[model samples]
Target: MSRITLENIHKTFGKVKALDGVSIDVKDKEFFVLFGPAGAGKTTILNCIAGIAMPEEGVVKFDGEIINLVETAKRNVAMVFENYALYPQMTVYDNMASPLRSDLYRQNEDVIKERVYAAAKMMKMENLLERLPSQLSNGQKQRVAMGRALVRTPNVFLMDEPLAHLDAKLRNAMRTELKEMQANFGTTSIYVTHDFMEAMSLGDRIAIVNQGKIVQIGTPDDIYYLACNEFVAQLMGDPEINILSGLLRKNGDNYSFLSNGSEFVLPADAALMNKLAAYDGKSVDIGIRPQHVMYSFSKDAGYRDYQVYSYESIGNKSVIEAYPAGHSGRGDTHTHVRMIAPNGLTIKIDQLIYIDFKLDHTMFFDGSSKEFIGCYNEAGIRALSAGKEEA
Candidate 1:
């Protein structure tokens, strides 16, 4: 097992900053995920740790010792790239056994065969052992690359979108195997990908990176239930969270948000009041995951009016999108409200309906900073930041 650390790493390509002060402490035997969109620096971080690319600033450490000056060959990190970097001339057996034959790990022929066979089994490539790289399909080549990495008993495993181009079914299956392989090997590993499902399913912990910065770091639920900012919330969800811009209103001793003709009652929360004190009556972005939304045949308890612009049924779930019913001429023309519910409901586009916000399950954010202000508890009264208010 290895404990890998990247301290305030900074890297630049020409005028573009690839990574900026990104720091992460990957625990021993932990499966850490670096998740972000393309060009967000996921691969760069992996390279920095492997000594493939040196950071302009900060230090890279392995098990408490600085490895900033170490050579890539001496780092003892095994990397499986999206593009299979296998030797075309070598057969799969030779490719998988190459590491064992190297000076770093001069294992006997019998031991090399044993390790290669074990890795081939893990990657489901036992039958493709003798195929050359050119004779195999892309997916088969990917397994070969993964098998090569797995056969090595390296200090850390760096995987950069290793399953990205596989078919959906194969990708899902690999996720399970990857998790199991990491557990059995207990090798400190960092896997990078743009897929939220991969990160949620395989990571022991995840770091959400964006535009050269780490936005938030936590478990899948911590990021889903409590987002640090609008970007993180938007990135983690499929249909995305509903973010409405409005102002907080003072109703005697109570408070609520009024957007067009729709009103979202604020949960009774002192912490929320404190957070919103400065911005009371000013615009704030209200975010609610689509799943937390509930529909009404007519105006029911806590139901607000809306105008459905579109309704879609996708297998097990249906999505309803709308804006406030009476806000047509109020200048908020682009405001959209969406709700996700179990499918098999009779609904139509252009229909006027009432929907409940489930306010306690909703999230509030500062309009200017786009930072989470609070979310109402299920009891309809407490609040927390994207991480429950940073307190």
Candidate 2:
């Protein structure tokens, strides 16, 4: 295993800038993922690393050695693309063995057979070895492509949406299998995907890229819990984090925020209030996840009362949609706030309901800048303003 590093990388296609001084470090044997929306330059980064495309500037290094001048084959890296990229005329076995047949890395016939069989077994393609690429299903053909990449035991692995073509069930199964394969081989791998779930599950560290720049890079928990900005906070979670506008103010000795006419005391630290002091009268966006909102009976003790507008039971859990009387105009007429409920909760649309928020899970941000102000804690909210104290 080896570390792959990109420093000040830049790439452009005619008028479009694909990569803009993008840089990331893939630790030895770590599963690093590049995640973003479409046209975010994910594939361009992979191509630069694979030597398929050269960057206009910056260095590509493998384990501390520069490799920009190296040929793609000499880079000793394997890439599994979205399309199966299998030859229609070749059988699964032939496809798997193609990488080993290269004269660049000569091995005896027995050695090649052993490697091919091992890769086939890992991908569960041993039974389909004799089937031609044309005769196999999409999932089976993709397994062959993965097998071909695995056969060589390269220093690094680059997988570009390898499971995109598979059905949901098969894709899930392959996700588990791919993680296991990476663990078993301990090869440094770079995975690129638009799916947030995949990035959260498969990556040891993820770089969330946007518009040819890395917005954030950290472990899944770090990125999810401590998002760098509003774009990232909204992009990383399921059902998406809810963003509501509010006005911050000081009332007596306490600090509170008002949304429409509804008001709540700030549960964050006084220092954080000071940090946000400048935006006192301005609109700020508050974010809360679906899971953090609790649903209860109208008379439940310690519950803040609310009214249910609509809801949908999605099997194991229910999505309780409600409307804040004060913020009614800001929300959609059809749906306002949504809370995930436990089973056996008897609830109906337009029902009188009550709910409470998990203060610890709340996040605040500057309305205009869209950057996180701080995270809420029992003592109050703690500011992450280490260097920007002036702000």
Winning model by TM-score? 1
Cα lDDT of candidate 2 equals: 0.81
lDDT of 1: 0.84
Give a tens-digit lDDT track for model 1, residues 1-391.
7999989999999999999999999998888999999999999999999998889999999999999999999989999998999999999999999988999778999999999999998877889998899999887888899889888889999999999988888887877877677667678989999998899888878999999899898877677766889888888887888887788877655678987566766777776666767777878888888887888878888787787777888567888877777666245644777788767877776678888777767778888899987765522332322343232
lDDT of 2 by residue, 210-232 (tens): 99999898777767777888899
Residue pairs with backbone overlap in model 2: 268-380, 268-381, 269-380, 269-381
Give the 10-residue window scoring lowest on summed lDDT in candidate 2. Answer: 380-389
Local distance difference test scores for all models: 0.84, 0.81
Model 1 RMSD, rounded to 1 decimal: 3.9
